[model samples]
Target: MTPEPRSGRPRSSSREVLSEAACELFLEQGYDATSVSDITRRAGVSRSSFFNYFAAKSDVLWSGFDEQVNAAARRLRGGEAVDAALTGIGDGLAPDALALAITNADAMGIAGELDRDRAVRQFRLQRELAARFVRDGMPQLAAEVRAGALAAAVLAAVWAWADRTAAERVLRDLLATTIALA
Candidate 1:
């Protein structure tokens, strides 16, 4: 059990603990069954403390996903291809990547209340990718559609693999393919 997150902004350590607790509970009790109270208890924090870090249990489950999205954006700007960037983070970065991400996202012990947030987060990530494509001189409409497709493909692949060696293999393959294209 970890100490509660400070009253102000949530600390990384606390957030990590929350995420771990959420994962454990989600796996043990199933995402649909686990409660915020269960997670807080597992994390050794009070209910209020749990709320301090994450508005809900789902937020705790998907806490680091947004970070991965940002990493993808950075990787794109750094001259690394999309597949290479996905491989660097996990394994596959295409169709397989989306599957892995979905599975991983689902593992976060999400409650019904958090579905809207999850969907919105995904939409926002797609938008980010679309903006990146526009910067690369793609036409606005084409870039938007392509960005959404690319983001969707990557997310789907990630969900399918769900933190497995297959995910790693997919990522490596993507990197290799990207390098070949370059």
Candidate 2:
């Protein structure tokens, strides 16, 4: 007889588990003190499994938001309106790794690193937004300025949403509000 089939979760779930474990460990032991091995152990996965899901421990926290950024890039490339593409990027986003990291940055001893990484992401999005603006006939300097403001507002909206109780989050709406306020 064949062994019973496992009702196992999708392989992708390991990423989530690893992120959760990493965040908990970071909060408990501090970022530098928590190794990839510690996250793997806490996640009940192998080191190889962790590597398969994440290039580095930092990826565990940033991957979700990175995907959103990339998706926005694709939309911009396809010539969607900047406001539509950028604001809608957070639609259907759940409170995932980025949210956890944002809320717990200080507690996890990751405030400095988080800020650095956040700037990288912000600038990356700004570049894409600026390119799209240029494509739509704005001057380079003006495009850069507008993109910088919009990108800052987008990230700020994410921070605001993460800081709030989960029940209060509707990221796209908050994004629209933030962009308008900006």
Candidate 3:
């Protein structure tokens, strides 16, 4: 077990451990076959501890990205330019976690199962981003279009990163380019 940080909360290492353990189990036993108990047992953590960090098994794969998205949304709401906001979001990508999931997607049986959930989350993110842009003085339709494009770009970049074809490309750069085109 990791020691608690100064704030008396377990260090972020606990989350990492859970995520790593979940991914390994997903890859080995298949995502459908792995339960929260299995992940907790592998991580040597309590069930409550797992709940403290993740709402569901799939969350182990997306929580980091979701955190980044929320941060970017906050920046957007703070009047940051769309490009800069998207760049911030890209900058938040957890390379190691994402790479692990992408590389083991097939083995984990997550490739097809993720689309619907991902699409829903992406749409919600797009709406929130668009709303922020509108509050920042952009026209509604324009904000919506820009948000949609930026959201799509983020998805594309994740896919590219996972595919390992963008080995030399930085996520922020991809986001910047996509925003520029938008």
Candidate 4:
């Protein structure tokens, strides 16, 4: 017998299960050594199911940012623009799920690449956010750019700090600097 085909809607639970399994393997065996087949076997799902959920393993880390960013944008949409943007970013980063992603060695293995992806994402998000702020009568592109810059900078700072200090301290400093810059 064959399995039924998936429709276009996102399958959150399966994706979440695959992501959790991937993180566990990544933490245990390291990222480079883990394969899609290994992840599929561990998750007790077929290869097709995994592909239906994520384009690639790295995508799991990328998935939640947009939703969180949108949520942040909504929260800050009508408020003091820079303050609102930072608040959104800070809130986005504070979730425990993010901690799990970062702590995994396989996830960390993708860090350099992910950082680049993040910077690009930040730039795109900033451009959209700047437009939103402007439409709401905010006049400062520089401030908005600064807020976005600080957001990306905070992540880089946290990566560096994580090497020498605790994750909490790194996060605290990142939040402080991001907020201060905005």
- CA RMSD per model (angstroms): 6.7, 2.4, 3.7, 5.8
**What lDDT is reached at residue 131 by model 4?**
65
lDDT per residue for candidate 1 within 1-182, as digits (tens), equals 99976574346677777777777776677777888888888888788988877776667645555566677668877767655665565421343222333455555444343446656665776787677678878899998887666655654444444446443456545434433433
lDDT (0 to 1) per candidate: 0.61, 0.87, 0.79, 0.62
Clashing pairs for predicted structure model 4, backbone only: none
Candidate 3 wrong stretches, greater than 4 Å: 1-9, 137-139, 165-167
Question: What tens-digit string does per-residue lDDT give for candidate 3 at 74-178?
Answer: 887787876777788767575755567777778888877677657867797799888987887889999999888878877776667657744667877776776
lDDT of 3 at 116: 63
Q: If both were scored by TM-score, which would come out higher, candidate 1 or candidate 3? A: 3
Best by lDDT: 2
Give lDDT for model 3: 0.79
Candidate 2: what lDDT? 0.87
Least accurate 10 contiguous residues by lDDT in model 2: 5-14
lDDT of 4 by residue, 46-132 (tens): 889888867877666556655666666675665545554554554534333345655543544655655666676677667666666
Candidate 1 structure lDDT: 0.61
Please give the distance, in angstroms, between residue 132's alpha carbon in candidate 3 and its true position after superposition: 2.1
Show model 1 residue runs off by greater than 4 Å: 1-12, 74-88, 91-121, 163-182
- lDDT order of candidates, best first? 2, 3, 4, 1
Point to the candidate with the largest TM-score. Answer: 2
